[model samples]
Target: MNAPLSLTTPAVSVDIAGVNLSYGTNHVLKDVNLAIEPGEFFAFLGPSGCGKTTLLRLIAGFNQADTGHVRIGGRDITDLPPWKRDVGMVFQSYALWPHMTVRRNVAFGLEERGVKRAEVERRVETALGLVGLAHLADRRPSQLSGGQQQRVAVARTVAIEPKVLLLDEPLSNLDAKMRVQVRRELRDLQQRLGLTTIFVTHDQEEANTICDRIAVMNDGIVQQVGTPMELYERPANLFVAGFLGTANILKGRIVGSGAERYFEIDGGTRFPIPEDDRIPDGAALVFRPQHATLTDQAGPQDGALSLPCIIANREFLGASIRYGARIGATEVAIDVPFQSGKYLFEIGSSGWLKLWPRSLHWLSV
Candidate 1:
C-alpha cells in the first residue's frame, strides 16, 4: 500500500537530452530528446519494441542511458539511483504483494523510510480512501477485482507523494469497459494532485483520450510529438500520418506548371494541389476517409474533385458505414455516417466521390 498524497508538492518538469541506449547491437533508443512540462499528463505512444517503455524506464532510473542527460525540475539526475529520484512508477503487472493487505502495501514505502506509526496509519487510510478502496484495506490483492488491484497499485504509488508519476500500461490488464472507466479516474486523480505524469502505452485510443500530448515512436525512434488533434490533422511525415489514424495514401505526380498545376493519379484521375509552395516531385496525396463524400453522380464540383470509383466492399460500423472503393489502380476508403436506411450501394456498384481540394494533404513519398 502507498501513503496518502499531499497536493502541496509542486509538479516538476522533465527534460531528456541526447539519450542513446542499446542492448549490444540492437540500438534501442536513438538520440531521443523531449521536454515535458510540469504538471502535464504526457504519453509515450507506440507499438511494441518501439522503445517507449525503455524511455520510460530511463526516466525512472531503471535503465541507464549510454549518452544522455536526464533532468527533473531542472536538476540533473541522470546518475541518480531509482529510490533517490523521487519518481513513482506504476508498472504494467500491478506488482502488488499478494500476501499483504492493501493497507500494508500502500504503507510499505512510508514504513521503509522510517515514518512514525501514527503518521503512516493516517496517510495509508487517506491514500486508500482517495482510491475509493478504504473499505477494502484489509483485503488481499488476490481477493480483489482487476480494477481494484489496479487502483491498489495507483494508491500505492500516489501515497508516496513522488514528484513525478510514471505509468507503464497500467490499464492494459483491465477489460475494455473497465479500462475506459479507470482511465477517466486516472486523469482526474492526476489533475487533482497536480503531478507531472508520463504514461507509456501501445494503445492509440488510450493515449488520445487520456493525455494532453503524445510522442509517437517507432523502430526505436521518436516519429512525431504533438497533441492528438495536431498529429491527426497535420502529421509531420508518412509514418506519422499512417500510424496515428486511418489515412488513404494516394500516389500521384505533379503535372502542369504555376496555377494550372495538379496531381494526376496513375489512372488519369486528377486533383488540384495547393499553391504557394513547391510540391515534391514524387509526393503522395493523403486524406482521411471521412473527408470524402460518395454520390451516384460522376461530376466534378466548383471546389471539389470528383473521382470515379467502384464500391468493392462496405462495412457497417454501427454509427457510420465504411466503403472500400477502387479508383484506377489504387484503392481508397470512404466513410459515410449511417442514417437509418440511407441509400445503400451494392459491392460491385459504381459510385463517384467528391473530395475537397483543401482536405487533401501532401507528403513526400
Candidate 2:
C-alpha cells in the first residue's frame, strides 16, 4: 500500500484588512477585516447576496477588493494574480474536466507549474490516494458519483500544495445523507492536512459543525464573529440573535424599577426583570425556543420567568416537540424533548411557559 500523505503540511495565516467591494452602484462587502490563524478551519456564513462567497473569491484572487489589502502568512498579495498567490479554491460546481482521467485532473495544476515528470507522477498518485480514489485514477469525471467528484476536486486543490485552501459551499451539490457523511470526511481530511482553510456557506449547521470559528455576515456587514457556542448562546445583537438560530423575540416595554422592576409585553403579560437600570424602557427580550419549558402550572420558581400562555400549535418532530404559544398579544415558540407517554397539551390548551431569567437576552426594539 502507498504511504498516506503527511498531515504536517505547511499551514499559513490569512489576514484581510479594510476590504471593500462594489459592482457599479451595488456595494457588496464593506470594511471587512479578519485575521485567521494558521490551521484554523474558519467559516464565512450568511444568506445569499450577503457577500460570503464574494469574500472567499477575494481571498482566492478571483475578485479584487476596491479598497484594501490581503496578506497570506504576513506577505502582502493584493496585487498578485490567482496563480501567484499559492491558494487553491474548490469551486462550487466541482469544475472537473469531463474528458480527462482523475489522475490527469489532479496533476494538471502541477504540470502547468512545470514540476518535473517524476515528481508530478508521485504527487498525482499521492493526491488520489489521500482522497481514497487511487484505484479510480484512470476513470473520467463522468464515471464518479457526486461525493467522489467532490473529493476529486478537493484532491486536485490539495495536490498543488497551496498555502491555503478555499471551499465555496463544496458540499451543497450532494444529497442530504451524502452531505453529512462527506462533510465529516472533509473535516477529517482538513485536520489531517493541517491546511489553513476557509469555508463559505449559508447553512448555519454546516458552519457550526465544521468550523473552529465563524464570522456571521449580513448585508455587507459582519454581524458577529465567534465560536459556534459563543455565537449561538451570546449573540451580539438582534440580527445575530435572530440569524444564528430560532429566537423568540418578545417586544415589550420595561416598566417599574428596583426590586419590583419588570418588563411588560405589549399584549398584557409581565415578566420580572431583576435589573432594569441598564435596559431601555422599550426593548425586546429574546430566548431560544429550546431553553423554554412548557408546563400546565402557574407557580414561579427561583431564577425563572413564568408566562401564562395557551398552546397555539404543536409539531411532532422526530426527536422533540415544538410548540407555539400565545402570551398576551405576542406569540412565542418553545421546544421540548419528545416523550412517548408524556402528557402533551393540545392546540388552544391553557398552559404556562417557563424560561430561566439567565437565559433572557435584551436587545433594542
Candidate 3:
C-alpha cells in the first residue's frame, strides 16, 4: 500500500477575454468573454451546438481561438500546447485504457510527464483513494461499473494536479439514478480539492444543482450568466426565459398611455402595467406555470390579471398536476399542487387564469 498523499493545491482564476473562434465561415464562437473565479464551481450550460464544448476545449489548449486570449492565474497561455497547459479535462466518454489496470491508468499522465516512478505510484494510489476506488486499483476498466470508470478517469486527471479542472458532460453516459449519485460525488470531490472547476452540460437540473454559477449559451453565443435562480427568475430575453425552465410566454401589445398603460394579449387579457415596470416594445408576457391560478370569477383580484381560458389537457406529475390552459389561440401551462381530496379540473372546462403582476416577466424574442 502507498502512503496517503496531501492534495492542498492552490486555486487559480481562469479568464477569457474577447475570445472568438471560427471554423472557416461557420463562426463557432462569438466575441465571448468570461471571468471564472478561483475555486468556483462554474458551469457552461446549453443545448448541443452552442459552443460550450468549443469554449471548454479552448481553455484546455485543444482548440485555438481565432482572436483573444485565455489567461490562467494571471498568466497568458494562449500559445501553450496541451501538455504545457496545466489544465485537466475529463471528456464525456470517460476515455480509459481497457487493458490497463485502474492504478496504471491513473499513473499514465504522471508517467508521460516524466514523473519519478515512486512518486507516480504514490500519486496514483492517493488519487484512487480520494475517489474511494483504492480497493479496486488492480481491476481493469472493462471490469468496473460506469460510475467506477468515471471515477478512474477523474483520478487520472487529478493525479497530475492540474490548476483547473474541465469536465465536459462527464455524467452523460450514466443512467439517470447514477447521474444523480455521481454528480453529488463529483461536487463533493471538487469542494474537497478546492479546485477551480468548470462543468459543461445541457441538463438544467444538473447545472442548477451542482454549479455555483452558469453561463447559458445558444446559437454559439452566450445568452446569459448568473445563478440558476437568478437566470430562472430574471431571464434576459425570451430565449433565456424558455430555455432555463418551463415558461409560459404570450405575445402582447402595450396599450393605453402614461401611468394607465395596459398590456393587451391576443387572448383578450388586459393587464395593467405598474409604473415601476418598464415594458419594452415587442416584449412578450412571460410567467412560470405556478404563477397563475384557475378561478371561476371573471373579475381580477389580488393584483393579478384575469384571463379566460379552457382546460385543454392534464398531466399527472408526481407531486403536482400540470394543466394545459388555452387562452384564445395560445396555450399555456398551469401547475396545481396535488392533494387527496382537492377539486380537479376536467379537460374542456372553462375557467379564468388569474396571473399575479409581480410574478410576470417582460421578455423579447
For all candidates, what are the clash counts? 6, 0, 0
Over 16-100, each residue of candidate 2 has an lDDT whose tens digit, in order, gives: 9999999999999999999999999999999899999999999999999999999999999998999999899999999999999
Runs in model 2 lying further than 4 Å from the true structure: 4-9, 280-282
Tens digits of lDDT, candidate 3, 125-144: 88998899999999999999
The 0-to-1 C-alpha lDDT of every candidate, in the order given, reads: 0.90, 0.90, 0.91
TM-score of structure candidate 2: 0.96
Error of 3 at 99 (Å): 0.8
Q: Where in model 1 is the C-alpha error above 4 Å?
A: 1-4
Would you estimate the TM-scores of all the predictions?
A: 0.96, 0.96, 0.97
- Lowest-sum lDDT 10-residue window in model 3: 1-10
User: Regarding TM-score, does 1 or 3 come out ahead?
Assistant: 3
Give the poorly placed runs of model 3, Cα more than 4 Å off: 1-9
**Candidate 2, poorest ten consecutive residues by summed lDDT:** 1-10
Enumerate residue pairs that collide in model 2: none
